[model samples]
Target chain A: MPHDHHDHDHLSASGHPYRKDNDGQLTYWQTMEIAIRELMVEKGELTPAQIQAQIDAMDDRSPANGAAVVARAWTDPDFKKRLLANGSDAAREMGFDIGPMHLVAVENTIDTHNLIVCTLCSCYPRNLLGLPPDWYKTREYRSRAVREPRAVLREFGVDLPANITLRVHDSTADMRYIVLPARPEGTDEMTAEQLAELVTRDSMIGTGLPKSP
Target chain B: MTLTPGSTVRIKTMSPLGHIRTPHYLRGKTGVVERVLGPFKNPEQLAYMVPAPTRTLYRVRFEMGHIWPNAEAPQDTLDAEIYEHWIDQNAP
Candidate 1:
Protein backbone atom coordinates (compact mmCIF):
# COMPACT_ATOMS: atom_id res chain seq x y z
CA MET A 1 0.00 0.00 0.00
CA PRO A 2 1.05 3.67 -0.39
CA HIS A 3 1.06 3.97 3.42
CA ASP A 4 3.88 1.44 3.72
CA HIS A 5 6.56 3.96 2.66
CA HIS A 6 5.07 7.02 4.40
CA ASP A 7 5.39 8.18 7.98
CA HIS A 8 2.39 7.03 10.05
CA ASP A 9 2.36 9.92 12.52
CA HIS A 10 0.63 12.45 10.25
CA LEU A 11 -1.20 10.12 7.86
CA SER A 12 -4.76 8.86 8.23
CA ALA A 13 -5.98 5.33 7.49
CA SER A 14 -6.59 6.35 3.85
CA GLY A 15 -2.94 7.54 3.57
CA HIS A 16 -4.11 11.13 3.12
CA PRO A 17 -2.87 13.89 5.42
CA TYR A 18 -4.80 14.22 8.69
CA ARG A 19 -7.00 17.26 8.06
CA LYS A 20 -10.21 18.33 9.78
CA ASP A 21 -12.06 18.44 6.47
CA ASN A 22 -10.82 14.96 5.43
CA ASP A 23 -12.89 13.21 8.11
CA GLY A 24 -14.76 11.01 5.60
CA GLN A 25 -17.58 13.55 5.38
CA LEU A 26 -17.86 14.97 1.87
CA THR A 27 -19.10 18.56 1.83
CA TYR A 28 -21.58 19.87 -0.72
CA TRP A 29 -18.86 21.71 -2.63
CA GLN A 30 -16.60 18.67 -2.54
CA THR A 31 -19.42 16.50 -3.90
CA MET A 32 -20.05 18.94 -6.74
CA GLU A 33 -16.33 19.18 -7.55
CA ILE A 34 -15.90 15.40 -7.68
CA ALA A 35 -19.01 14.94 -9.82
CA ILE A 36 -17.94 17.69 -12.23
CA ARG A 37 -14.40 16.40 -12.48
CA GLU A 38 -15.54 12.87 -13.18
CA LEU A 39 -18.06 14.04 -15.79
CA MET A 40 -15.41 16.21 -17.50
CA VAL A 41 -12.93 13.32 -17.56
CA GLU A 42 -15.55 10.92 -18.93
CA LYS A 43 -16.64 13.40 -21.60
CA GLY A 44 -13.01 14.04 -22.70
CA GLU A 45 -13.17 17.73 -21.76
CA LEU A 46 -10.08 17.34 -19.55
CA THR A 47 -7.63 14.57 -18.80
CA PRO A 48 -6.73 13.54 -15.25
CA ALA A 49 -3.07 14.28 -16.02
CA GLN A 50 -3.91 17.82 -17.11
CA ILE A 51 -5.78 18.47 -13.85
CA GLN A 52 -2.86 17.11 -11.80
CA ALA A 53 -0.41 19.26 -13.76
CA GLN A 54 -2.47 22.40 -13.04
CA ILE A 55 -2.57 21.59 -9.33
CA ASP A 56 1.18 20.92 -9.34
CA ALA A 57 1.87 24.25 -11.03
CA MET A 58 -0.15 26.10 -8.39
CA ASP A 59 1.57 24.22 -5.56
CA ASP A 60 4.98 25.12 -7.04
CA ARG A 61 4.25 28.85 -6.60
CA SER A 62 5.37 30.34 -3.27
CA PRO A 63 6.30 33.61 -1.57
CA ALA A 64 9.87 33.11 -2.77
CA ASN A 65 8.84 34.39 -6.21
CA GLY A 66 7.67 37.67 -4.63
CA ALA A 67 10.81 37.82 -2.46
CA ALA A 68 13.09 37.67 -5.48
CA VAL A 69 11.20 40.56 -7.05
CA VAL A 70 11.44 42.61 -3.86
CA ALA A 71 15.18 41.93 -3.56
CA ARG A 72 15.76 42.99 -7.15
CA ALA A 73 13.86 46.23 -6.53
CA TRP A 74 15.92 46.96 -3.42
CA THR A 75 19.25 46.44 -5.20
CA ASP A 76 18.39 47.98 -8.56
CA PRO A 77 16.82 51.44 -8.63
CA ASP A 78 15.85 51.16 -12.30
CA PHE A 79 14.08 47.86 -11.73
CA LYS A 80 12.42 49.35 -8.66
CA LYS A 81 11.11 52.23 -10.77
CA ARG A 82 9.75 49.80 -13.34
CA LEU A 83 8.25 47.62 -10.59
CA LEU A 84 6.53 50.65 -9.09
CA ALA A 85 5.25 51.82 -12.47
CA ASN A 86 4.15 48.41 -13.77
CA GLY A 87 4.30 45.40 -11.42
CA SER A 88 3.01 42.86 -13.98
CA ASP A 89 5.77 43.61 -16.48
CA ALA A 90 8.40 43.75 -13.72
CA ALA A 91 7.40 40.27 -12.50
CA ARG A 92 7.40 39.00 -16.09
CA GLU A 93 10.92 40.43 -16.50
CA MET A 94 11.95 38.03 -13.73
CA GLY A 95 10.51 35.11 -15.82
CA PHE A 96 7.45 34.58 -13.59
CA ASP A 97 4.31 34.17 -15.70
CA ILE A 98 1.58 35.91 -13.63
CA GLY A 99 -1.02 35.24 -16.35
CA PRO A 100 -3.62 38.04 -16.84
CA MET A 101 -3.34 39.40 -13.32
CA HIS A 102 -2.97 43.17 -12.98
CA LEU A 103 -0.38 43.62 -10.21
CA VAL A 104 0.08 46.91 -8.34
CA ALA A 105 3.16 47.49 -6.17
CA VAL A 106 2.66 49.99 -3.34
CA GLU A 107 5.80 51.28 -1.67
CA ASN A 108 6.28 51.51 2.08
CA THR A 109 8.44 54.47 3.04
CA ILE A 110 9.54 56.06 6.32
CA ASP A 111 6.50 58.34 6.22
CA THR A 112 4.01 55.93 4.63
CA HIS A 113 2.89 52.36 5.33
CA ASN A 114 0.71 50.28 2.99
CA LEU A 115 -1.65 47.44 3.91
CA ILE A 116 -3.71 45.17 1.57
CA VAL A 117 -7.09 43.53 2.20
CA CYS A 118 -9.96 42.16 0.11
CA THR A 119 -13.21 43.02 1.90
CA LEU A 120 -15.52 41.39 -0.63
CA CYS A 121 -13.62 38.17 -1.17
CA SER A 122 -10.12 36.69 -1.03
CA CYS A 123 -8.59 38.36 -4.08
CA TYR A 124 -4.85 37.82 -3.72
CA PRO A 125 -1.78 37.83 -5.92
CA ARG A 126 -1.56 34.05 -5.86
CA ASN A 127 0.60 33.96 -9.02
CA LEU A 128 3.29 36.06 -7.35
CA LEU A 129 2.90 35.40 -3.59
CA GLY A 130 1.33 31.96 -3.74
CA LEU A 131 -1.84 31.42 -1.65
CA PRO A 132 -2.69 34.02 0.97
CA PRO A 133 -2.40 33.24 4.66
CA ASP A 134 -5.45 31.76 6.41
CA TRP A 135 -5.88 34.88 8.54
CA TYR A 136 -6.21 36.96 5.38
CA LYS A 137 -9.37 35.07 4.39
CA THR A 138 -10.99 35.38 7.81
CA ARG A 139 -14.09 37.62 8.07
CA GLU A 140 -12.54 39.56 10.96
CA TYR A 141 -9.39 40.44 8.99
CA ARG A 142 -11.40 41.42 5.93
CA SER A 143 -13.72 43.71 7.90
CA ARG A 144 -11.27 45.31 10.32
CA ALA A 145 -8.34 45.73 7.93
CA VAL A 146 -10.14 48.67 6.35
CA ARG A 147 -12.22 50.02 9.26
CA GLU A 148 -9.45 50.02 11.86
CA PRO A 149 -6.21 49.32 10.07
CA ARG A 150 -3.93 50.61 12.83
CA ALA A 151 -5.44 48.31 15.44
CA VAL A 152 -5.31 45.37 13.07
CA LEU A 153 -1.66 46.05 12.24
CA ARG A 154 -0.89 46.28 15.93
CA GLU A 155 -2.44 42.86 16.45
CA PHE A 156 -0.01 41.49 13.85
CA GLY A 157 2.90 43.01 15.90
CA VAL A 158 3.24 45.92 13.48
CA ASP A 159 2.94 49.12 15.51
CA LEU A 160 3.24 52.25 13.44
CA PRO A 161 4.26 55.67 14.71
CA ALA A 162 1.75 58.54 14.54
CA ASN A 163 3.97 60.38 12.09
CA ILE A 164 3.73 57.63 9.52
CA THR A 165 0.62 57.65 7.35
CA LEU A 166 -1.14 54.32 6.85
CA ARG A 167 -2.72 53.38 3.52
CA VAL A 168 -5.15 50.46 3.45
CA HIS A 169 -5.91 49.03 0.00
CA ASP A 170 -9.13 47.11 -0.52
CA SER A 171 -8.87 44.65 -3.41
CA THR A 172 -12.43 45.17 -4.62
CA ALA A 173 -11.91 44.50 -8.33
CA ASP A 174 -9.46 43.33 -11.02
CA MET A 175 -6.14 44.62 -9.62
CA ARG A 176 -4.01 42.70 -7.10
CA TYR A 177 -1.71 44.58 -4.72
CA ILE A 178 1.75 43.87 -3.26
CA VAL A 179 3.44 46.08 -0.71
CA LEU A 180 7.01 47.07 -1.56
CA PRO A 181 8.28 47.14 2.03
CA ALA A 182 11.07 49.50 2.96
CA ARG A 183 14.51 47.93 3.11
CA PRO A 184 15.91 47.52 6.58
CA GLU A 185 18.94 49.64 7.36
CA GLY A 186 22.54 48.33 7.37
CA THR A 187 22.16 45.81 4.52
CA ASP A 188 24.27 47.75 2.02
CA GLU A 189 26.82 44.94 1.60
CA MET A 190 24.29 42.17 0.90
CA THR A 191 23.73 40.74 -2.58
CA ALA A 192 20.29 40.63 -4.22
CA GLU A 193 19.93 36.94 -3.34
CA GLN A 194 21.07 37.61 0.22
CA LEU A 195 18.57 40.47 0.47
CA ALA A 196 15.79 38.17 -0.76
CA GLU A 197 16.44 36.03 2.29
CA LEU A 198 15.19 38.88 4.52
CA VAL A 199 12.01 39.51 2.53
CA THR A 200 9.20 37.78 4.41
CA ARG A 201 5.75 36.91 3.01
CA ASP A 202 4.02 39.12 5.59
CA SER A 203 6.20 42.09 4.57
CA MET A 204 4.85 41.90 1.04
CA ILE A 205 1.29 41.65 2.43
CA GLY A 206 1.94 44.73 4.66
CA THR A 207 1.05 42.98 7.90
CA GLY A 208 4.68 42.73 9.14
CA LEU A 209 8.04 44.26 8.30
CA PRO A 210 11.06 42.54 6.73
CA LYS A 211 13.53 40.77 8.98
CA SER A 212 16.47 42.81 10.24
CA PRO A 213 19.97 41.65 9.23
CA MET B 1 -18.52 59.71 -18.11
CA THR B 2 -14.71 59.51 -18.38
CA LEU B 3 -13.11 60.19 -15.00
CA THR B 4 -9.59 61.62 -15.04
CA PRO B 5 -7.02 61.04 -12.33
CA GLY B 6 -7.29 63.50 -9.40
CA SER B 7 -11.01 64.07 -10.02
CA THR B 8 -13.21 63.88 -6.94
CA VAL B 9 -16.12 61.46 -7.33
CA ARG B 10 -18.63 59.67 -5.13
CA ILE B 11 -19.47 56.00 -5.29
CA LYS B 12 -23.12 55.37 -6.20
CA THR B 13 -25.20 53.88 -3.39
CA MET B 14 -27.17 51.06 -4.97
CA SER B 15 -27.91 47.69 -3.41
CA PRO B 16 -28.86 45.53 -6.35
CA LEU B 17 -29.19 41.91 -5.31
CA GLY B 18 -26.66 40.10 -7.49
CA HIS B 19 -23.00 39.20 -7.83
CA ILE B 20 -21.52 42.70 -7.52
CA ARG B 21 -17.83 43.45 -7.23
CA THR B 22 -18.48 46.72 -5.35
CA PRO B 23 -18.41 46.34 -1.59
CA HIS B 24 -21.38 47.67 0.44
CA TYR B 25 -19.16 49.69 2.77
CA LEU B 26 -17.92 51.94 -0.08
CA ARG B 27 -21.38 52.97 -1.24
CA GLY B 28 -22.14 56.72 -1.07
CA LYS B 29 -18.52 57.44 -0.15
CA THR B 30 -16.51 60.19 -1.86
CA GLY B 31 -12.91 59.80 -3.04
CA VAL B 32 -10.37 61.05 -5.54
CA VAL B 33 -9.45 59.05 -8.60
CA GLU B 34 -5.82 58.04 -8.12
CA ARG B 35 -5.44 56.22 -11.42
CA VAL B 36 -7.45 54.89 -14.38
CA LEU B 37 -6.86 51.11 -14.51
CA GLY B 38 -8.18 50.72 -18.09
CA PRO B 39 -11.26 48.76 -19.19
CA PHE B 40 -12.36 45.32 -18.07
CA LYS B 41 -15.43 43.12 -18.41
CA ASN B 42 -18.20 44.07 -15.97
CA PRO B 43 -18.21 41.36 -13.32
CA GLU B 44 -21.95 41.71 -12.68
CA GLN B 45 -22.80 40.14 -16.03
CA LEU B 46 -19.75 37.90 -16.17
CA ALA B 47 -20.74 36.28 -12.86
CA TYR B 48 -23.91 35.00 -14.50
CA MET B 49 -21.98 33.57 -17.51
CA VAL B 50 -23.52 36.20 -19.79
CA PRO B 51 -21.90 38.63 -22.21
CA ALA B 52 -20.32 41.56 -20.31
CA PRO B 53 -19.39 44.95 -21.68
CA THR B 54 -15.99 46.43 -20.86
CA ARG B 55 -16.07 49.25 -18.29
CA THR B 56 -13.29 51.58 -17.18
CA LEU B 57 -12.02 50.88 -13.64
CA TYR B 58 -10.46 53.55 -11.44
CA ARG B 59 -8.33 53.39 -8.33
CA VAL B 60 -10.04 55.78 -5.91
CA ARG B 61 -8.33 57.02 -2.74
CA PHE B 62 -10.31 58.01 0.37
CA GLU B 63 -9.22 59.55 3.64
CA MET B 64 -10.01 57.48 6.72
CA GLY B 65 -11.68 60.48 8.36
CA HIS B 66 -14.09 60.80 5.43
CA ILE B 67 -15.10 57.15 5.73
CA TRP B 68 -15.43 56.90 9.52
CA PRO B 69 -16.09 59.67 11.96
CA ASN B 70 -14.34 57.92 14.86
CA ALA B 71 -11.36 56.89 12.81
CA GLU B 72 -8.31 56.06 14.94
CA ALA B 73 -5.97 57.59 12.38
CA PRO B 74 -7.74 60.40 10.58
CA GLN B 75 -4.82 61.05 8.24
CA ASP B 76 -4.66 57.44 7.13
CA THR B 77 -6.16 56.53 3.71
CA LEU B 78 -7.99 53.72 1.92
CA ASP B 79 -7.92 52.79 -1.78
CA ALA B 80 -10.24 50.62 -3.88
CA GLU B 81 -10.82 49.92 -7.57
CA ILE B 82 -14.28 51.06 -8.66
CA TYR B 83 -15.98 50.57 -12.02
CA GLU B 84 -17.06 53.55 -14.12
CA HIS B 85 -20.79 52.89 -13.73
CA TRP B 86 -20.45 52.83 -9.92
CA ILE B 87 -18.93 56.29 -9.77
CA ASP B 88 -20.95 59.58 -9.74
CA GLN B 89 -19.20 62.40 -11.59
CA ASN B 90 -20.88 65.28 -9.75
CA ALA B 91 -19.02 65.84 -6.46
CA PRO B 92 -20.23 68.64 -4.18
Candidate 2:
Protein backbone atom coordinates (compact mmCIF):
# COMPACT_ATOMS: atom_id res chain seq x y z
CA MET A 1 0.00 0.00 0.00
CA PRO A 2 1.07 3.60 -0.63
CA HIS A 3 2.12 5.82 2.28
CA ASP A 4 -0.53 8.10 3.84
CA HIS A 5 0.87 11.58 3.07
CA HIS A 6 -2.20 13.71 3.73
CA ASP A 7 -1.68 16.83 5.87
CA HIS A 8 -4.45 19.18 7.09
CA ASP A 9 -2.55 22.46 7.60
CA HIS A 10 -0.35 22.24 4.47
CA LEU A 11 -1.01 21.36 0.84
CA SER A 12 -1.34 17.66 0.06
CA ALA A 13 1.00 15.79 -2.30
CA SER A 14 -1.21 16.88 -5.26
CA GLY A 15 -1.00 20.56 -4.21
CA HIS A 16 -4.72 20.71 -3.27
CA PRO A 17 -5.98 21.44 0.22
CA TYR A 18 -7.21 18.35 2.00
CA ARG A 19 -10.99 18.41 2.38
CA LYS A 20 -13.04 16.37 4.80
CA ASP A 21 -14.09 13.77 2.27
CA ASN A 22 -11.79 13.24 -0.68
CA ASP A 23 -8.08 12.52 -0.10
CA GLY A 24 -7.03 15.82 -1.70
CA GLN A 25 -8.98 14.87 -4.84
CA LEU A 26 -11.33 17.44 -6.40
CA THR A 27 -13.76 17.27 -9.28
CA TYR A 28 -12.71 18.90 -12.55
CA TRP A 29 -15.10 21.84 -12.24
CA GLN A 30 -14.29 22.32 -8.58
CA THR A 31 -10.60 22.31 -9.39
CA MET A 32 -11.16 24.81 -12.18
CA GLU A 33 -13.05 27.16 -9.87
CA ILE A 34 -10.25 26.92 -7.31
CA ALA A 35 -7.60 27.63 -9.90
CA ILE A 36 -9.49 30.61 -11.33
CA ARG A 37 -10.17 32.06 -7.89
CA GLU A 38 -6.53 31.71 -6.91
CA LEU A 39 -5.37 33.31 -10.17
CA MET A 40 -7.75 36.25 -9.67
CA VAL A 41 -6.44 36.82 -6.16
CA GLU A 42 -2.81 36.51 -7.25
CA LYS A 43 -3.40 39.10 -9.99
CA GLY A 44 -5.12 41.45 -7.50
CA GLU A 45 -8.33 41.30 -9.57
CA LEU A 46 -10.20 40.36 -6.38
CA THR A 47 -9.23 39.45 -2.85
CA PRO A 48 -10.04 36.11 -1.27
CA ALA A 49 -12.06 37.93 1.38
CA GLN A 50 -14.20 39.56 -1.32
CA ILE A 51 -14.92 36.17 -2.93
CA GLN A 52 -15.93 34.77 0.44
CA ALA A 53 -18.16 37.74 1.07
CA GLN A 54 -19.88 37.22 -2.30
CA ILE A 55 -20.50 33.58 -1.48
CA ASP A 56 -21.94 34.60 1.89
CA ALA A 57 -24.19 37.10 0.15
CA MET A 58 -25.51 34.38 -2.19
CA ASP A 59 -26.28 32.18 0.81
CA ASP A 60 -28.38 34.98 2.33
CA ARG A 61 -31.27 34.27 -0.12
CA SER A 62 -33.79 31.45 -0.08
CA PRO A 63 -37.11 30.31 -1.50
CA ALA A 64 -38.97 31.94 1.39
CA ASN A 65 -38.26 35.30 -0.24
CA GLY A 66 -40.16 34.26 -3.36
CA ALA A 67 -42.96 32.80 -1.29
CA ALA A 68 -43.38 36.13 0.49
CA VAL A 69 -43.81 37.88 -2.85
CA VAL A 70 -46.35 35.31 -3.98
CA ALA A 71 -48.31 35.49 -0.77
CA ARG A 72 -48.43 39.28 -0.91
CA ALA A 73 -49.63 39.15 -4.49
CA TRP A 74 -52.38 36.70 -3.60
CA THR A 75 -53.62 38.82 -0.72
CA ASP A 76 -53.57 42.25 -2.40
CA PRO A 77 -55.08 42.69 -5.84
CA ASP A 78 -53.31 46.03 -6.30
CA PHE A 79 -50.01 44.40 -5.44
CA LYS A 80 -50.83 41.56 -7.80
CA LYS A 81 -51.46 44.09 -10.58
CA ARG A 82 -48.17 45.77 -9.87
CA LEU A 83 -46.31 42.46 -9.77
CA LEU A 84 -47.78 41.36 -13.07
CA ALA A 85 -47.03 44.77 -14.58
CA ASN A 86 -43.46 45.11 -13.32
CA GLY A 87 -42.00 42.24 -11.35
CA SER A 88 -38.69 43.85 -10.35
CA ASP A 89 -40.39 46.92 -8.88
CA ALA A 90 -42.99 44.76 -7.13
CA ALA A 91 -40.27 42.60 -5.62
CA ARG A 92 -38.60 45.78 -4.37
CA GLU A 93 -41.83 46.78 -2.64
CA MET A 94 -41.44 43.57 -0.66
CA GLY A 95 -37.77 44.47 0.13
CA PHE A 96 -36.28 42.03 -2.38
CA ASP A 97 -33.54 43.43 -4.61
CA ILE A 98 -33.54 41.53 -7.93
CA GLY A 99 -30.39 43.26 -9.18
CA PRO A 100 -30.17 44.48 -12.79
CA MET A 101 -32.00 41.69 -14.61
CA HIS A 102 -35.58 42.26 -15.75
CA LEU A 103 -38.13 40.08 -14.01
CA VAL A 104 -41.57 39.16 -15.37
CA ALA A 105 -44.36 37.71 -13.27
CA VAL A 106 -46.61 35.32 -15.16
CA GLU A 107 -49.97 34.53 -13.65
CA ASN A 108 -51.54 31.11 -13.87
CA THR A 109 -55.22 31.50 -14.62
CA ILE A 110 -58.07 29.00 -14.79
CA ASP A 111 -57.43 28.51 -18.51
CA THR A 112 -53.68 28.80 -18.65
CA HIS A 113 -50.60 27.70 -16.72
CA ASN A 114 -47.10 29.08 -17.17
CA LEU A 115 -43.88 27.07 -17.01
CA ILE A 116 -40.38 28.56 -17.05
CA VAL A 117 -37.22 26.98 -18.42
CA CYS A 118 -33.78 28.11 -19.49
CA THR A 119 -33.09 25.86 -22.46
CA LEU A 120 -29.56 27.11 -22.98
CA CYS A 121 -28.56 27.48 -19.35
CA SER A 122 -29.86 27.40 -15.79
CA CYS A 123 -30.62 31.09 -15.55
CA TYR A 124 -33.03 31.61 -12.66
CA PRO A 125 -34.55 34.31 -10.44
CA ARG A 126 -31.86 33.81 -7.84
CA ASN A 127 -32.71 37.07 -6.05
CA LEU A 128 -36.15 35.85 -5.03
CA LEU A 129 -35.82 32.07 -5.10
CA GLY A 130 -32.15 31.69 -4.14
CA LEU A 131 -30.01 29.20 -6.02
CA PRO A 132 -31.87 26.77 -8.27
CA PRO A 133 -32.24 23.14 -7.31
CA ASP A 134 -29.61 20.72 -8.62
CA TRP A 135 -32.03 19.18 -11.11
CA TYR A 136 -32.72 22.61 -12.61
CA LYS A 137 -29.11 22.73 -13.77
CA THR A 138 -29.15 19.27 -15.29
CA ARG A 139 -29.31 18.77 -19.03
CA GLU A 140 -32.31 16.47 -18.56
CA TYR A 141 -34.47 19.24 -17.08
CA ARG A 142 -33.37 21.84 -19.61
CA SER A 143 -34.21 19.77 -22.72
CA ARG A 144 -37.25 17.96 -21.32
CA ALA A 145 -38.86 21.17 -20.11
CA VAL A 146 -38.94 22.72 -23.57
CA ARG A 147 -39.97 19.53 -25.39
CA GLU A 148 -42.50 17.88 -23.05
CA PRO A 149 -43.34 20.23 -20.23
CA ARG A 150 -46.53 18.49 -19.13
CA ALA A 151 -44.70 15.23 -18.68
CA VAL A 152 -42.00 16.99 -16.69
CA LEU A 153 -44.66 18.63 -14.49
CA ARG A 154 -46.28 15.27 -13.85
CA GLU A 155 -42.98 13.99 -12.51
CA PHE A 156 -42.92 16.94 -10.12
CA GLY A 157 -46.45 15.92 -8.96
CA VAL A 158 -48.16 18.84 -10.69
CA ASP A 159 -50.99 17.46 -12.80
CA LEU A 160 -53.07 19.90 -14.78
CA PRO A 161 -56.28 19.44 -16.71
CA ALA A 162 -55.91 18.89 -20.43
CA ASN A 163 -58.25 21.79 -21.10
CA ILE A 164 -55.93 24.16 -19.30
CA THR A 165 -53.41 25.33 -21.90
CA LEU A 166 -49.82 25.12 -20.69
CA ARG A 167 -47.59 27.98 -21.74
CA VAL A 168 -43.86 27.32 -21.53
CA HIS A 169 -41.52 30.28 -21.32
CA ASP A 170 -37.95 29.71 -22.48
CA SER A 171 -35.64 32.16 -20.73
CA THR A 172 -33.10 32.33 -23.53
CA ALA A 173 -31.54 35.69 -22.82
CA ASP A 174 -31.42 38.14 -19.89
CA MET A 175 -35.05 38.05 -18.74
CA ARG A 176 -35.84 35.93 -15.71
CA TYR A 177 -39.34 34.56 -15.07
CA ILE A 178 -41.35 33.62 -11.98
CA VAL A 179 -44.75 32.02 -12.04
CA LEU A 180 -47.56 33.26 -9.80
CA PRO A 181 -49.58 30.11 -9.40
CA ALA A 182 -53.26 30.47 -8.81
CA ARG A 183 -54.10 30.37 -5.14
CA PRO A 184 -55.53 27.13 -3.86
CA GLU A 185 -59.32 27.12 -3.60
CA GLY A 186 -59.56 27.04 0.23
CA THR A 187 -56.97 29.79 0.82
CA ASP A 188 -59.51 32.61 0.59
CA GLU A 189 -59.53 33.05 4.38
CA MET A 190 -55.84 32.57 5.08
CA THR A 191 -53.68 35.53 6.06
CA ALA A 192 -50.77 36.52 3.84
CA GLU A 193 -48.22 35.16 6.30
CA GLN A 194 -50.08 31.89 6.65
CA LEU A 195 -50.45 31.58 2.88
CA ALA A 196 -46.74 32.13 2.37
CA GLU A 197 -45.98 29.02 4.36
CA LEU A 198 -47.84 26.95 1.78
CA VAL A 199 -45.78 28.23 -1.13
CA THR A 200 -42.88 26.02 -2.22
CA ARG A 201 -39.82 26.80 -4.33
CA ASP A 202 -41.05 24.47 -7.06
CA SER A 203 -44.30 26.45 -7.25
CA MET A 204 -42.48 29.65 -8.19
CA ILE A 205 -40.56 27.70 -10.83
CA GLY A 206 -43.91 26.43 -12.24
CA THR A 207 -43.13 22.77 -11.50
CA GLY A 208 -45.38 22.60 -8.42
CA LEU A 209 -48.35 24.37 -6.78
CA PRO A 210 -49.12 25.85 -3.40
CA LYS A 211 -50.27 23.32 -0.81
CA SER A 212 -54.04 23.08 -0.53
CA PRO A 213 -55.28 24.29 2.81
CA MET B 1 -33.54 48.82 -32.18
CA THR B 2 -36.87 49.73 -30.60
CA LEU B 3 -39.71 47.28 -31.12
CA THR B 4 -43.36 48.18 -30.59
CA PRO B 5 -45.07 45.68 -28.34
CA GLY B 6 -47.78 43.63 -30.10
CA SER B 7 -46.14 43.94 -33.49
CA THR B 8 -45.49 40.61 -35.19
CA VAL B 9 -41.83 39.81 -35.86
CA ARG B 10 -39.81 36.95 -37.22
CA ILE B 11 -36.55 35.69 -35.74
CA LYS B 12 -33.91 35.72 -38.42
CA THR B 13 -32.34 32.37 -39.29
CA MET B 14 -28.60 32.76 -38.91
CA SER B 15 -26.23 30.18 -37.42
CA PRO B 16 -23.14 32.05 -36.37
CA LEU B 17 -20.17 30.01 -35.21
CA GLY B 18 -19.71 31.55 -31.77
CA HIS B 19 -21.31 32.01 -28.36
CA ILE B 20 -24.91 33.04 -29.10
CA ARG B 21 -27.79 33.51 -26.71
CA THR B 22 -30.50 32.60 -29.24
CA PRO B 23 -31.29 28.91 -29.11
CA HIS B 24 -31.29 26.76 -32.23
CA TYR B 25 -34.92 25.72 -31.70
CA LEU B 26 -36.11 29.31 -32.10
CA ARG B 27 -34.26 30.00 -35.34
CA GLY B 28 -36.55 31.31 -38.10
CA LYS B 29 -39.50 31.10 -35.70
CA THR B 30 -42.14 33.82 -35.85
CA GLY B 31 -43.29 35.64 -32.72
CA VAL B 32 -44.95 38.79 -31.52
CA VAL B 33 -43.06 41.45 -29.61
CA GLU B 34 -44.53 41.18 -26.13
CA ARG B 35 -42.39 43.92 -24.58
CA VAL B 36 -39.08 45.72 -24.85
CA LEU B 37 -36.79 44.45 -22.11
CA GLY B 38 -34.39 47.43 -22.43
CA PRO B 39 -30.71 47.47 -23.41
CA PHE B 40 -27.89 45.53 -21.82
CA LYS B 41 -24.23 44.83 -22.58
CA ASN B 42 -23.82 42.03 -25.11
CA PRO B 43 -23.30 38.76 -23.28
CA GLU B 44 -21.67 37.18 -26.29
CA GLN B 45 -18.80 39.63 -25.96
CA LEU B 46 -18.96 39.67 -22.17
CA ALA B 47 -18.19 35.95 -22.23
CA TYR B 48 -14.76 36.94 -23.56
CA MET B 49 -14.30 39.42 -20.70
CA VAL B 50 -14.19 42.33 -23.15
CA PRO B 51 -16.02 45.62 -23.17
CA ALA B 52 -19.03 45.39 -25.51
CA PRO B 53 -21.72 47.77 -26.73
CA THR B 54 -25.21 47.54 -25.29
CA ARG B 55 -27.95 45.90 -27.29
CA THR B 56 -31.73 46.12 -26.99
CA LEU B 57 -33.59 42.99 -25.90
CA TYR B 58 -37.24 42.11 -26.36
CA ARG B 59 -39.65 39.63 -24.89
CA VAL B 60 -41.33 37.80 -27.76
CA ARG B 61 -44.32 35.47 -27.58
CA PHE B 62 -44.91 32.58 -29.95
CA GLU B 63 -47.82 30.20 -30.39
CA MET B 64 -47.11 26.66 -29.26
CA GLY B 65 -48.06 25.22 -32.61
CA HIS B 66 -45.65 27.54 -34.32
CA ILE B 67 -42.74 26.30 -32.25
CA TRP B 68 -43.80 22.67 -32.16
CA PRO B 69 -46.34 21.50 -34.68
CA ASN B 70 -47.37 18.52 -32.58
CA ALA B 71 -48.09 20.63 -29.52
CA GLU B 72 -50.92 19.08 -27.48
CA ALA B 73 -52.92 22.29 -27.16
CA PRO B 74 -53.16 24.73 -30.05
CA GLN B 75 -53.88 27.58 -27.68
CA ASP B 76 -50.69 27.00 -25.71
CA THR B 77 -47.90 29.59 -26.09
CA LEU B 78 -44.22 30.13 -25.35
CA ASP B 79 -42.35 33.32 -24.56
CA ALA B 80 -38.61 33.93 -25.00
CA GLU B 81 -36.24 36.89 -24.69
CA ILE B 82 -34.38 37.62 -27.91
CA TYR B 83 -31.86 40.32 -28.68
CA GLU B 84 -33.00 42.97 -31.17
CA HIS B 85 -30.26 42.02 -33.60
CA TRP B 86 -31.69 38.50 -33.95
CA ILE B 87 -35.09 39.68 -35.22
CA ASP B 88 -36.11 40.58 -38.77
CA GLN B 89 -39.21 42.04 -40.46
CA ASN B 90 -42.61 40.64 -39.59
CA ALA B 91 -43.75 37.54 -41.42
CA PRO B 92 -46.48 38.22 -44.01
Best by TM-score: 1
Candidate whose DockQ is highest:
1
lDDT of 2 by residue, A1-213 (tens): 132344466775537665554355778977887799999999999997797778767777788888999999999999999999999999998887667757899999989899999989899999778789889999999998877788899999988898998989998887789999899998888999999999988888899988988
Tens-digit per-residue lDDT, A143-162, candidate 1: 99999999999999999999
Q: Which stretches of candidate 2 lie over 4 Å from their true place?
A: A1-32
Give Cα distance to truth, residue A169, candidate 2, Å: 0.9
Candidate that scores best on lDDT:
1
State each model's CA lDDT, in order.
0.92, 0.86
The DockQ assigned to candidate 1 is 0.93
State the DockQ of every prediction. 0.93, 0.73
List CA RMSD, all candidates: 3.2, 6.2
User: Tens digits of per-residue lDDT for model 1 on B1-92?
Assistant: 77799999999998999999888888999999999999999999999999999999999999999999999999899999999999876656
C-alpha DockQ for predicted model 2: 0.73
Model 1, stretches more than 4 Å misplaced?
Answer: A1-8, A11-29
Q: Candidate 2 - CAPRI tier?
A: medium
